[model samples]
Target: MAAARESLLDAAGAALARRPWPAVRMVEVAAAAGVSRQTLYNEFGGKDGLARALVRRAADGYLAGVERALAGNGGDWERLTAVAEWTAAAAQEDALVRALLTGCWSERLPAPPRGPAPVPAQRRPEPPLPSPPDLVRIVRDRAVTALSGPGTAPAATVELARSCELVVRLALSCVTAPPGEGGIAGLIRTAAPRTAL
Candidate 1:
């Protein structure tokens, strides 16, 4: 069932890439996924449900990348640079990620649902896609938790959070108006405060 769900989602995502979500057909998605239409419905409930799941999955995937960048070996600022770089790059490569981060959902992409679908398969409803500000807060909090070494002072933690948010916001800026020569890392280096995250 999990495999079918993933395949269906992948198919839906691919179909979305080719055309607008409204134009993507259940039959084609099921065929592309090698699952029956009924199986697709069972996994996602319907197109709206699938859109919600897609947005949720994109958020999860982006956050997972942030975690990896934060967890990997690096100096304090380097870890944040990695996260910022990933943010810009992911938004460039994935329309869903870009839309979620920028709140500029073009007609080509799916507008996230208002709320969760009452799908039995969902068990628990997936959280709505984070707004851009929500995403900033989420990323800032994650960076603080990951980078705040044991027993850091609260004041220091607050300062570190500020640094982290600076990096994230700079990355967001890069997503909207790309940097000129040195790319996002250069932008971060120039714009980031003397303190590092």
Candidate 2:
């Protein structure tokens, strides 16, 4: 079942890369994955559900990369600076990451209408897709933990965490709108960890 789900998500992702989300049909995704339409619907519920799952998968991958960046060698500042540089490069190279960072998608078509049939008054609206800020918070929390790891005094942990948050915010800002020549490196260098007051 998990393999089936993965296969469908992979197919859906491929479709997304080639065209807008609205044009991606579940039947086509099923056909692409060699799964039945029922299997696709059973796994993802609907197009909205599939979209959420796709975004979640991408977000998870991005966060995993962040974990690697935070765990890389050198002091906190150096690791964070590396991550900032990485984020900038990734935003330019990957459309999904760019969409996650910028909350704007060049390839995403307009979302389809709620449903073909009218909704019941008692039925709740579908859950909203995870917001871009949610992704930021996940990265920030991980960074705080990474920044505060070993050798960090308990007293300084809070301030160090705040620094991590700032670093993440700045990196995200760079992703949203790339800096001018030499500007990104300067941003990262300036964000380097300082002694917590």
Candidate 3:
């Protein structure tokens, strides 16, 4: 069942890449995934439900990468640098990720629907999609958790969170204007000194 859901999402995403969401057909998506149309309706109540799931999947995948970046071996700044680089690269490669980070959903993409729909017990509702600032806060908080060593003082934790937010915002800046020569890593080094961060 999980496999079918993933396949359906993969098919939907591929279709979205080629054409706008308004043109995406439920039956075609089902056929592409090798599932029956009835199965598609069963998994996700309808197209809107699928859109919510697809958007949620994108957010989850990006955050998972963030976890990986934060967990990478190195000093705290180095981990933050990994996160910045990951953010830049991901926003460049995947439109859904870019939208999730920047909060700019073009008409071509399915604007995440306004509300949630009830689902089967197996399908838990993803938390509400974050605003752009909320996403930044989420990343910053996660980084702090991953980077803060045990027995760290509250004051130091607050400082670490500030560093995390700075690095994340810098990465987001690079997403729009892009960096000059050294790219995200260089920009991060300039903004985040290893001594303080």
- Give per-residue CA lDDT, model 2, range 26-54, as digits (tens): 89999999999988877766776677667
Predicted structure 1: lDDT: 0.88
| CA lDDT, candidate 1, residue 172 | 95
Structural similarity to truth (TM-score) of each candidate: 0.95, 0.78, 0.94
Worst ten in a row by lDDT for model 1: 115-124
By lDDT, is 2 or 3 better?
3
Per-residue alpha-carbon lDDT of candidate 1 for residues 1-197, written as tens digits (9 for 90 to 100): 88988898899899998899889999999999999998888777888888888888899999999999999897888899999999999999999999999999888888766755667565566766789899999999999999998999999998988989999999999998999999888888898885645
Ranking by TM-score: 1, 3, 2
Provide the lDDT at 12 for model 2. Answer: 92
1 against 2, candidate with superior lDDT: 1
- Candidate 3: list runs displaced more than 4 Å: 118-123
Clashing pairs in 2: none
Reference-based lDDT, residue 133, model 1: 96
| Model 1 ranges with Cα > 4 A deviation | none
**Given candidate 1, what's the lDDT at residue 22?**
83
Model 2, runs deviating above 4 Å: 105-130, 150-155, 191-193
